[model samples]
Target: MSCSEDPTCQELLDHIYELVDADEDAIDERSRALLAAHAAVCPSCRDAVDAERHVRELLRRCCGESVHAPAALRVRVVSMTTRVRRTE
Candidate 1:
């Protein structure tokens, strides 16, 4: 599906992160095109991209490395995974 067809915010956010983090020259043509297309029209997602970039820069300046995900998020992910697995 085209990027426009991807209705989920998480997909757009993931694409934005990939665009910011991946080497442009190393990315495949299709992926690059998809990111470009998505960023062109999605202002909210673009703001998210900008925010992520700013955070990364701040982390680099202050901590010299990216911060780890919060413990709460990790715990939530583990709990969700266990719940899903038990239902299977």
Candidate 2:
């Protein structure tokens, strides 16, 4: 079934961006299962993930390796991300 037809799949797709931006080593077993199962079987989500990955890679390459944010900015970003995750 398409993700649009399944609530669980839609939820998975909704959070797929978090998966795309996540470091491989940061994913726990359950998170890995969700990503693996849906991304492997869902053609639309697989394509979406691929596109997101490409954009991430391109940005990293274009922005250059080792670009560092100011410490305050980094802290704010982490704090914001944490807050968002908590709310979710």
Candidate 3:
């Protein structure tokens, strides 16, 4: 989190969210590689990058993949499930 007065430091902070998200649509591999290379030489950037990844990892572990709906809710939705045909 010590951004250490580098011009590129702000660049890293700006794109940190897109970088950590790991979505290609959000950030291309080349841009990510450039940022990573910058972080490699800069201790400050490296620490910030690592911390962001760590926080996201912790959230994934704590929340898990998916939650099951309540049994009653599931049953009610199933009962109400229906399809309507459209007339042209």
**Whole-model Cα lDDT of every candidate shown, in order:** 0.59, 0.60, 0.63
Overall local distance difference test of candidate 1:
0.59
Candidate 1: where is the Cα deviation over 4 Å?
1-8, 23-27, 65-88
Greater-TM-score candidate between 1 and 2: 1
TM-score of each: 0.53, 0.52, 0.60
TM-score of 1: 0.53
What is candidate 3's lDDT per residue for 24-87, written digit by digit as tens? Answer: 8987787777777788899877767776665555446766644444547533533333111112
Off by over 4 Å in 3: 1-7, 66-88
lDDT of 1 at 4: 67
Error of 3 at 27 (Å): 1.3
lDDT of 3: 0.63
Model 2 agreement with the true structure over 23-69: per-residue lDDT tens digits: 56655556656675778888766766665555456546767765544
Residues forming the 10-long window of minimal summed lDDT in candidate 3: 79-88
Writing each residue's lDDT as its tens digit, candidate 1 over 2-75 gives: 44644345665656546666766656657756666676678766656665566556556766675654647534
**In angstroms, how far off is 4's CA in candidate 3?**
19
Specify the poorest-scoring 10-residue window by lDDT in model 2: 1-10
